[model samples]
Target: MTEIEFQKNFSQLQYHLYTSPLPHVSNLHPHQKTIHAFFMLDHLREELQRKNESTLKTVNAKDFNLPEELHVYHSLYPLDQRQEKSIKIFGYPSWVYKSVCSVDGRVYCLRRIEGFRLTNEIAMSTIENWRRIRHANIVSIREAFTTKAFGDHSLVFVYDYHPLSQTLFDKHFSSSSLQANNHPQSGGTGVVVPETVLWSYITQLASAIKTIHSSGLAARMIEPTKILSTNKNRIRINCCGIMDMLTFDGGKNIHHFQQEDLIHFGQLIISLACNSLSSVLNLPKSIDYISRHYSPDFKNVILYLLNKPTPTKSVDKVIAMIGPRILHEINSVHHYNDFLESELSQELENGRLVRLLCKFGFINERPEFDMDPSWSETGDRYLIKLFRDYVFHQVDENGYPVVDMAHVLMCLNKLDAGVDERIMLVSRDEQSCLIVSYKEIKNCIDSAFRDLSRRK
Candidate 1:
């Protein structure tokens, strides 16, 4: 028999492998599983791409009349939505901006304390302590410096930027929450945070305070407005070193400030639980509400923190009291980690197929090789061209375009695996056809790509 005839016979045998039915592996429907997995991977990819775009995104400095540069940072984009409600937490009209660091090409959040002149260099050094203290629930202080880029003596602090993060205040206590509270049709229950989420916040805050106190610093600003809700039930303390700089004295009562941190932490929890900032103002009412709503252990923990200041009343004590609850938080974290890992694994094959498709793009329809009469549509390249049409450019019998993602995925997977399974590829004109194995097609792709690379 001729070599061409032998090849055609072998292709026919390989094609049977695909045509043959296989036993069910599991009870789960294959189509349903494939659809769910593909869609989830696509969503994750799109979200990651969006975050990446936001990170590298630059603003037109001229359009916004923004400063061309502030030391090593540039591309200043205001992170604050409402410039009208300026923050006075740092005892100055503070503005938030998202900027890119020219030195390392990293996006950072810049908290600019407007019109604040640094009289004491030691106050600048206060940020160094905060810079040293790092915790998962803290928005890490990078550096603080005074700049006149905003046409004022602005104290600008650089922090790690978390894209699409909302503050706890905005997430839970914004106009929506207020409107819900004032809704006449409903009772004044207001928007109550879930108990599990509240415990998560408590454990996280306790952990953060422990880190800060251990580093000889205090997180004086622990309110909802200063805490970022980066993800579902995930909170991080923002603007850590601002108060330290603004409230600078030559000598600080570190112990007293540490005690105050405990007080503020208690108030923060009470505020979240009551769903109102005013709840903290009336201590007895807040405690009574907590007693009525939350567990006894929660109320007791709050009472311990809100008690009179003593050297023994530290974050370590808080951690000790709520040690069992901490286990729940860590367990929740591990479960979430597993979920993300599963989601990530689903995208592994998609990434490989994307690379394979890219190779096809480079090798097929080459204008440079078009000059050569025997280039594409002649040999191995012809098979690849037909395979491309089989994979992406399919049509139904009625002449309508067929958009079958499952078919595309299956073909790509087979090609990537370089299986011995064979398929028939038809020419676009329907005048020619070829029976080829995926292994052979994969070889053709690699050969074509290599030739193109060497030519380049």
Candidate 2:
């Protein structure tokens, strides 16, 4: 039936039900109600198809198989692949067929499923909308296809293959316990990595969300598992692929993008930070120390729950207390600068002391160390070790290792040799010891190390 006629019939059915005297409409037979609901849903789908057809028609079939140069960044992964054997992955239902493709020498995932018939036009429109959106964190779509067979339909979406990256839940919650047990020294340490690394991930995640917001789209799903990172600096978000699936089934109802995205984004941040804190502090899952301390609203919710008259009052209060403490521990550097200054100073003091061979024009305006000082203690240790290895060479002094003037000048050419730029500057005459700055140190260390690694 035509969309309008179907809608009219569905509305008439709804009107009859609403006008019935029985408040509880359970008197209807189970099979009859089931059939009624099924037709109503079908009619709604038809109406949506009619409404979205014009927009979908604008999406050309040729766009799906565009040449490499003509394809957008999101379409690159899907277009370059030579289809491989089907595989099953977690998260999705078992019925969905999956394949792997090598695009630009990188593996990309392609999922094909039948039963949910999507028009080529609709698929193309979704791809087009995705192409215009750009974010550092969000994974770009590679390509999409739709096919129809005798009464059966299938849709395929191509996406960049992120190796060694799992959903946040998989990474933090599922794997952390096993990792903590197996590699107690590294992963089991109560300390998290430096704020720099954590902030790097957070900033990328926020930027991705911001991009989605700007594109007039909302990432309905924002969680750890959706956030992906390789060993490299790049982070890829898997929202577009999931959103495409939802839109294919007429589930894209984003009337309030900002509100919904913001809520989800907040939840994502809270979840990650909470999980990190729980792992590091050995706290329960529900207690989010970081959010409770940083977010007053969340804190209030916890407090209200704790105030309930129950035997678990003490336990609830303690859990509530844990969240704030985690937040405090992570963010405590904001209130005090001594810890960072001392740590940076110690790194410079221990590393090789590079004296100015000849007084070249040194700037009157010194370097700035304005970045956040609050880093996980483990991060501090890594930075220290990084300085010793790349920037400063250890020397034997009176039968003991010491960093002195000679070591500094010898390491001058090697200054900033590592990724963590922590350097030690000394005067040629060995009189002045001016710690240049942590920022300069990290830059010098990183550069020197990077160049050395590249040479090898």
Candidate 3:
């Protein structure tokens, strides 16, 4: 996406998230607030897709034109044999490419299905059904269009892309260190995934399933390749709408497919635990090993999901077994560039970022006069800009990112994105002066007495 378009979409997302939500309640838990923000964003996505439908009608799939906002990145391809095979199946060759939604500045995956016979009706209907879904743990669909192929029309689906995403299957089983750690007797105790992170993934997947089931949808695509691990060890179910669309003309009941989804999900969970790709073939042994290493509760849950009869198994039951978990880390992006973009946008919208910074004590160490109401507006503004730089930009003489304010804004300066967002500080002087906020500005007019009391 171009800089201008990205800034616009980024600003809109910020307004939705950082603002005091629609009803304006301040006491909501962080979980409630984030869920609400995700809901609003999901609703926004549905609305955009409806508007896109009209424009899509103007072109036939055989001679479709690439509209202005969707720029296809033709040069990107599968980096390895696994990826190539995954995107290409049944002897037909196809691939996924990167693209930018000039409209939203968000990166999207454009997967070309070479030989599918999708009537315009099925494509639109499938997209419409998918668009209504808004779960935070699901990879969202932006748009779907058809293109002309040599023998048929190809259906191309656009999906949200996460930077640095790797399949859960590859994450645990592909690496030597991880492989050795999962089998501790190998004498190479490598980086074992924290128990916290494993539990976190399990609970999040349960949440995603609950959301999907609530929508009366079955996620038939539940294998490891279809699950993506994002920054901060978060796992998201990918391809929410694809399998349903593929079966749109197949005449099978969705519930049948939904039950299959549960089967695969159970397989996926056990695969992670056992660190084996050929999980189903060793079902009995897998259960025995998991029972040996994990708790009785988890073992019971896995048995119910995989070995039990489908007529009796339940997702809610599994979730009840795993119980409740906090989802704050799932919402974060890992790359430094993404951090700066998300943080800078959060700060611009009504000072919640600044409020968070203050709560974390990054803004408490400023010079008294700069924060004092007696200072002229110009002086206060100058100090405020400097303080913003120090908190979000300045580095120490040791060449390390400062560790203040949750290390979010402070750490952004540690990467290349910092050069553009930060004030280009010369040295370490302003780290002592990070205090700044909109609260003080509001105090200048709304409550003089309050400000006077703060000073004392």
Candidate that would win on TM-score = 1
lDDT of all the models against the reference?
Answer: 0.81, 0.44, 0.55
Per residue, candidate 2 scores C-alpha lDDT tens digits across 307-360 of 424433322233343454446544644543564454345346333433221111
Model 2 CA deviation exceeding 4 Å by range: 1-107, 147-153, 175-197, 232-234, 239-241, 248-252, 276-288, 291-456
Every model's TM-score? 0.87, 0.38, 0.54
Q: Which runs of model 1 end up more than 4 angstroms from their true locations?
A: 1-32, 41-65, 85-87, 180-188, 370-374
Clashes (backbone N, CA, C under 3 Å), per candidate, total 0, 27, 0
Name the candidate that leads on lDDT. Answer: 1
The residue pairs that clash in candidate 3, if any, are none
TM-score comparison, 2 vs 3, better candidate: 3
Error of 3 at 444 (Å): 21
Q: lDDT score, residue 398, model 1? A: 98
What tens-digit string does per-residue lDDT give for candidate 3 at 150-258?
Answer: 3456667787766556777566766653645654322113343445566777777888888887777777667776688865466788766765665575434766666
Which residue runs of candidate 3 sit more than 4 Å off their true CA positions? Answer: 1-83, 87-94, 149-152, 175-194, 250-252, 324-456
Give candidate 2's whole-model lDDT. Answer: 0.44
